[model samples]
Target chain A: MKRTQFSLGFIVRRSMVHRRVRSLAALLALTVSAAVATTLLTLYVSLNRQLHQQFRAFGANIVLTAPDGSTLPSETLATVRAIAGSESRIVPFAYAVAQTADGAPIVVAGTDFNAARAMDSWWQVSRWPNAAAATPGSPVAAMVGTRAQGFLHGDDFPLTYNGHTLALHTEATLRTGAAEDSRIFIPLAAFTAWTGQSASTLEIQAPGSAAQVEDLLHRLRAALPGVQVHAVRQLVESEGRIVDRTRSLMLSSLVLIALTVGICVLATLTASVLERRRDFAIMKALGSTQHQVALLFLLEAALLALAGAAAGYLLGSLCAFGIGAWNFHATIPPLWQAAPAVLLLNLFVALLAAGLPMRILRTMEPATLLRGE
Target chain B: MATILQSAVGSEALIHLHGLTREYASRAGAVRALDQVTLTIERGEWVAVMGPSGSGKSTLVNILGCLDQPTHGSVRIAGTDVHQLSRQELDRFRAETIGFIFQQFHLIPYLTALENILLAQYFHSMTDEDEARRALASVGLGDRATHLPSQLSGGEQQRVCIARALINQPPILLADEPTGNLDAANQEIVQEHLRTLHRAGHTIVMVTHDPEMASLADRTVELHHGRIAAERRADLTAQK
Candidate 1:
């Protein structure tokens, strides 16, 4: 009698297809693990970038202050700009203690209204002083802070600094909940005329890593000698610690999920293999070598793992997109770079699960099993 | 009431066993199944082994089929020492040289009858669908090729087992109570297939407790307490 030529692949496919329930059970288990691993890794990669952007909203990590009771040179803003490049926003401020009509001492700050607005967009203000209305040599338009607004009786007020009188028109009121809430804002040009002082401080919004910020500080100190240039440790350190801790937490979670999923896959595969013990025995009795039997099982597991990995990649990428959009208001593309790691993880889990069952199959006595024992 | 045929019927002894013994370790010391028993079966002979339960009939067949190893003895089938071969070598020897038919009809329940036959060919070498179909037809299962073992009756399942056993075209076929699970009608059907194989010069060794089935063999070896009690020609027994 002629025999049909059957390859290992055909038998494996037939066996898997024939036992649809068991195959689906194993496939579902593997897919869940792969999905979890893919999602965590994807989030881990994008979270760093997203977190950095979020921290950017908290304003600058570097601030340059003048020496006590002294003012920075008027040329300091230009020098800092030249050194820090165009990636930074530099807003220089000049201060003056002025007396109002009622003889109350008030702190008045002068700066480029547009630059200040851009640098501190998170500042809550009722309205911003009209930059177009406060040109040089015009009626000084002031954006009074909540505390300073209490001293003014109306929109028009007169402030005297060192017996030099200047009339101010209140344009808006600001409420920043910080010390900025007690000062009044006017154009830098106007402050220079009223107080005869140049800029005294520089508030810089710089975008970079901590090392990059340190490099900028070094360059700033070198470029502007005798000026106090330093990183605001509160902002810089908190940002660094938050990002690092979050990454560590994410990594640990990924490992824990992988271990849990691996165990689940192992349990499901073990049961599947155990259920097929009779089939294995029959094959052994039909003169199949232990190696051949083990290869068959491995092939089956590899097939399941590959399929699950592909499906999980798709599912996890969608999850990452959802999380990114919900939290960061941005769509994160699929991290294809993680595909290899995901595949290896899934394969490792599958092969690890198959190890015990293959050993059991190898040592099984064909004669005893075939006798229905 | 007996005729002793030559053990070495041809140029060489087809199956030669010398002091074959198999022992199992139990809680109550060792249990000897086949103790220093030696036997030979020549080519183109249909020999039936008759014994009660726990008489080592299955153990002897297992050793002969290379499915088991003897604790202390040598088994040579067709001049190849079964006990001396490696695990892999014994697997090939079994695939190429021996065919086993069990009373339970151990066909893979998930596979069709035709696929079951092809499984044997896959283990032996490559599968030939035409050859598998012919094997099925020869066993009167040509129309039931696509039926799974579970879908078939007990007798039909046993026929599939027979087809699978002979698919590799081995010289030796071992049947351990091939018809032990069937009724009279199915038993006759299975016995007819066995007779056809025997006529085609197959070396058949069967284990059966039915004297009627034993009488149909060319020779019968009765075992009493793990030793051969009688070896005689089946024709002489029918004559008696």
Candidate 2:
């Protein structure tokens, strides 16, 4: 006499329970839609961070130098360092041509060894030669280029620069897929003392968004009027383009998958409703209003949407983590922003499918439908 | 039976119809499913409607049960002009004033037998599990309360249907070919239940092709081509 179950909810649960196969079909479609959406959306946000780090690894994006190959004032290095952000590393390079023992000319560059090594991550070195503690004619540890082995001839060689002969002891062989592979690297202090010259070029690894980097370049150029400042436009432009294109591609793919899943769910729900015409007719014959019958199907659809989206969000988060590991070599956290969109998309699809049957419910005659026709 | 007839609350004509007409659109112009029919049914009366196939018996039942609307007519049931009520009011009126029993039983396949009875109660007002169980026990289905329609035999399913229809204690029962799908023994069982309902003073409107089933009613009306062709009462039979 007291306890009574809310009948609409009861009907929804019983009807869905009875139609497990169809319910699962629709739920599966929704789950996959949410998962794919999550994967793409999570990746979309994280791709920019990952790609920026990758490009920074590839080397410097901004370069500063003097015009006509003239060396800048020694104070200019300090000036440029002050203007550049702390996250950036500015390495100075001084170049000189020294003749080997065989009288062959080889280019040499001197810079902060550690900063250069940190910025040029692609360079492979067997060992970094020690350039400390040396006399005028005494042998000094040198990093020999792989190509200069022919003329430089062994671990020990003699080089003459400005009529002064210096003995070189090779401690490392360097290989870079650039001109650096044919040159030698030494400590900037050592080269400056040996050649009596200051740095003529500065390589700046500015790690930030393209606009931020571009803004930095403009400030550096404006601050140093005599110095030539330019961005490595290839890397900067391509990085921007790649990130934009990747985001666009992910959005496009999510849209396509959502459409496909929506159509599939529509088909599944439509078939489910058609198959249960007898049930609807019986409910109507029992004096159920058209709105009540419609509520049953709508409630079932809403429940399926909620459950599928929740499960899918969890599944999609796992999938996004997997994609981050495989593609970006990083751990990407789930993007919570996609939860509402996924739920709404599934609801829209479910409602579209369920709403079609509501129209059919209005036109149906219980007597004709119950006649087993 | 006469003593039980006094159980009716009042005899102000439980159902009244005038110029009842229903038409359907067909490839060959309008098809009149029911044409110019006039009838009345009193509370506690058992009336059987006999007709051939396509004789509009289902159309009349559909109209009486408020499952469909007549093309041109007035239908007053339980002292309310049903045609004048809104769609929602009609549904409530139907649920409160009439119950349906189909030949196919038309029990929802997924619901248990007791749950089937509870469905009617749920639609009408509230679902009482205790009362639903009692309804099942009254129909000799106490042990079969948990059985789905698919698991129950034809006779058990029909009993579930009767329990479902009468759960709300409606004054009128519209049964269309109630035993058309049952074997002879099951038919007898179902017909005896109808007799008990009739003796209990529940007005019954039954459509059947079997004369034996029709003979159980106090009066029988014959329909032909959507018109009342003949009528017969228990005491005297008339052709017109």
Candidate 3:
């Protein structure tokens, strides 16, 4: 019994030494699925972080807008700002539409640029527009998005707006999420002067994590009457839901693939066990206990599973990472977090798949098993 | 005439089976592979079981080697009742008490002779590479230690199997048709080596259909329909 205690080294050697192909196949199946799971999970977490950062840079946690010409009362504005200040960063902007001298329609935003700068999560600036006056035709400058600048090709010069022609210079472009790509920014004075309107839309940033952003919006509504506000929660919810569905579909596909691999492993192992029945019988006849035979088979399985999992993980990850960078044109995280999980899961799967063959070991009657019936 | 019991207790007798029976159920029907049979093999005694196909010679050898269990009787080897032992205990007993040789040579194809021999020791010890090498040398395969089973001739492959069986220095060796797959010259060469092993005081039990091969052993037992048909002693032949 002591000699037959089933040492780890013995199991490993017997598995690899006796049945190389079946062991390798099983291990490969497990490793591949592990890598897939790891890579997908890592990408999901990282994407959420990236999206949240971009939304934060929009200069407020929440935004409230009213249709044209209904100015918010000064006291209502003061009360709204006060309630938001407890756990949020609040900013007010007057939103309207205007036309360039060439009759191109544009969105006009009038705001306190300094306060907006402090509240926005993601804004890059070469310089903030000056509040001081400029010539009648040439007003204080504004920042425009990359897509908005796309409309003003480099060759187009001395842009005109509102019946007055002024020099439109391209400053550094600030990016928002995909939805915000077409927006343009201008100084409040310039916008109010051109549009001849004096009403405001409120953008509020609630304190705490992104999850709490929604609660802040609800609280803001209860505090302020007749004011409508839009929170980043709307954006986050829709995006998160889409990501969840995608992850579910991807996981289901992986499971199916894993099942196929499991079958391959099972077939290989079962064949291996049948082929070696004589060997097992000989050993048993020579004094190998049933447990020792079982150990030998189990050890063989573990070795195969480990090898297959490692190879599959490496191969799958390489493909996934490559596609994310080249085809999708996105930065994929390094994905080291998935390695251990993949390895463990692969081992488990290999063991599970090897269960059928283990039964073959138990039923092996040494005298008969060796007879080649 | 000496009964099987008296000869079993002599300094030579290492295994004794009493009223042994083995039954098996296959798709065809229930079959009795071994009938009520009493036999004894002395320590260091080289013996052969000879009969036609399906005559239970292989079954008798399997019972002697502990690779099988008799359904109806007791099997005692080295003073231990084999039938009383658990499955794991039986494996340990086999590892410690017996070695086995086969007609096909059963050497793992991918492994070199050295690795193949070392395989037998795996279940018994943690590490014994040098011992395995020494065992291979005992069978005159030291030069061919690194050769795969495919690379070796039939005789050399059988030598590797012999080396593997001898690695543990067990008291009993069971060979099932060790030369059944060998060419005549290789068979003679293997037969010579087995004689040398017997001269060195290792107990060997072989099962074969060849009367010529059976002639080389110290004793021959003939089985027919799962029962002993005849038993002969080499000493008696020498005396005549």
Candidate 4:
């Protein structure tokens, strides 16, 4: 017999089809493992950046506050920008207690409405107050928080601070679902003019790694002397803790599921090999070496694993998308880099699971094995 | 006296076994399967092995087929000490030398008839589909090449098994109760194929209890326990 162009692939492929039930069971095991692995890994890797962005949306992680009863220098925002770069959103804020017409005091916040809109993206606003839209010397435009809207109404209202009165008209209604909901916002120019106070705080969104953020913090402290530069450790710590816990949860889940799939595949493949003992015996009797027979089985497993990994990667990406939307109201992009790693992992799992059956196959004596039949 | 094939006892003898013993170890201690059994068969001779259950007939054939090794003594086939070769070398030796047919027909149920024959060729050397089809055709199953073992009748399946066994063209053919699982008509069909193979000058070793089947062989050796008890030449029995 001439050794023509023979294909082990055909044998492996046809054999998988022949034993459809066992092959499907093994495939299901590998597919589930890969899917879960892809989902958790995608979430874990994406969430590190995602959670950081979420925390930023929650508010700033770095706040610049002037110490004592003083106020920040006029050059503080410029200095912070020079250090933090254009990527950072620096919104300087000032606050004063002002009395309404009925004598009730409400907290009025002075901020750059443009910068605030960029920094506090989570705020749901009815509309933003455009300074250009207001005519010169007309009533000042104020964006009122939803909670503060009840106190000051009728489109325009008067508030007196330190014997100076400013008439403000509602330009927008802001709802932040947080402390910002209980205050009122007016342009820094109008507030500084009415209250005779400079900007006192700057909420900074520094986008970078922890090391980069620390470097930025160090530069901020060095640049502004007598100015208090502090990180909003609450937000930073919460972000860190949430990300850490989420990663731990993902790692444990991936491990548990991997172990479970490994065991299930082990059992499934073992049973498949056991059921085919006769076939193996016949092969051996027909002059197939132990190595050859084992190779055939492992090839089948690898084929199953590779296929399962591809299918699982696709399904898992969709699952991650669904989970991201359900939990974060966001879309999680597929991590393409994880594809090769996932393929290798499933192959390792399948080959490892098949090891036991091959061992059994090695110990088998074709004559003794086929004796019962 | 146990009779041997007089015409085959020359340089043409293809199998030589001397004091071949096979033992099985169990909790009940070791049990001897083939005790000091010496046998020889020349090339192109048909020999039948006859015995009751547990009489070591299968064991003898298994050792002869190189599926089992002897605990003592040796088997030399085609001028090579089968046991002296390494495990891997012995596998190759078996592939080039022996073909086995079992009573159950032992066809890989998943493979089609053509594929079953191709499997043997695959393990031995190369798989030739045309050659495999022709081998199937020789056994009167050429049209059923695409049929699975489950789809074939008992006799047809046996023919496919025989084609698979011969596809590699091994010098020796080993059959263990080849007709044991077949109906009367199927048995006759299988027997006729065996007779055709015998006439084609292929060496055949068949294990059977049917006297009529044994009479088809050149000689029949009856086994008792682990030892040969009686032998008869078909030519001599015909003379009687």
Best by TM-score: 4
Output the TM-score of candidate 2: 0.88
Per-residue accuracy of model 4 over A1-373 as CA lDDT, tens digit each: 3444546677777788888888998888888878988887888788777777776787687989999857898888888888899978899899998998888889999998888888888889998888667677799999888888888758899999999988999889989888888788998988898999989999999875566677888889899978888887777666767778877888888788777876777777677777778888898888988789888888888888998999999998989889988888787999998798889888888887777877876665688878753
lDDT of 3 at B218: 88
- Please give the range of 10 consecutive residues that has the lowest summed lDDT in model 4 chain A: A1-10
lDDT of 2: 0.83
Worst 10 residues of 4 chain B by lDDT: B1-10
Give a tens-digit lDDT track for model 3, residues B148-210: 888999998998888888888777888999999899988987898889889988899999888
Between candidates 1 and 2, name the one with more favorable lDDT: 1
The alpha-carbon RMSD over the true interface for every model, in angstroms, is 2.2, 1.6, 5.5, 2.4
Q: How well docked is model 2, in DockQ terms?
A: 0.59
Candidate 4 versus the native: TM-score?
0.89
Instruction: Give the CA lDDT, 0 to 100, for residue B62 in model 2.
Output: 89
lDDT tens digits by residue: candidate 2, B26-141: 99999998999899888788889999999999899989998888999898777666778777776677777788999889998878898888889888888888888888887789
User: Native-contact fraction for each model?
Assistant: 0.59, 0.63, 0.44, 0.54
Which residues of candidate 3, in runs, are more than 4 Å off? A1-24, A43-62, A66-92, A95-185, A192-199, A203-213, A222-227, A230-260, A269-275, A282-296, A319-329, A334-336, B1-13, B125-134, B235-240
Candidate 1, B107-151: lDDT as tens digits? 987689999999888887888899899999988999999998989
Candidate 3 residue lDDT tens string, A1-373? 2233334465457546555565455555455565665556555545545444444554555777664568666676677767666545666677655555456666656676666777763565556555564456643466666566666656233434555554455444556655335555666666666656555777765544445666667776787657776766665565556555755776777667656655665565566666767666655654556777666666666766667657766765676677567744556655676677666776676566456666766665677677776
The candidate with the higher lDDT, 1 or 4, is 1
Question: lDDT order of candidates, best first?
Answer: 1, 4, 2, 3
Tens-place lDDT digits, model 4, residues B131-205: 987899898888998898999998888888898899888778999999888889988988898898899889999
List DockQ for all candidates.
0.49, 0.59, 0.34, 0.49
For candidate 4, the docking band is acceptable
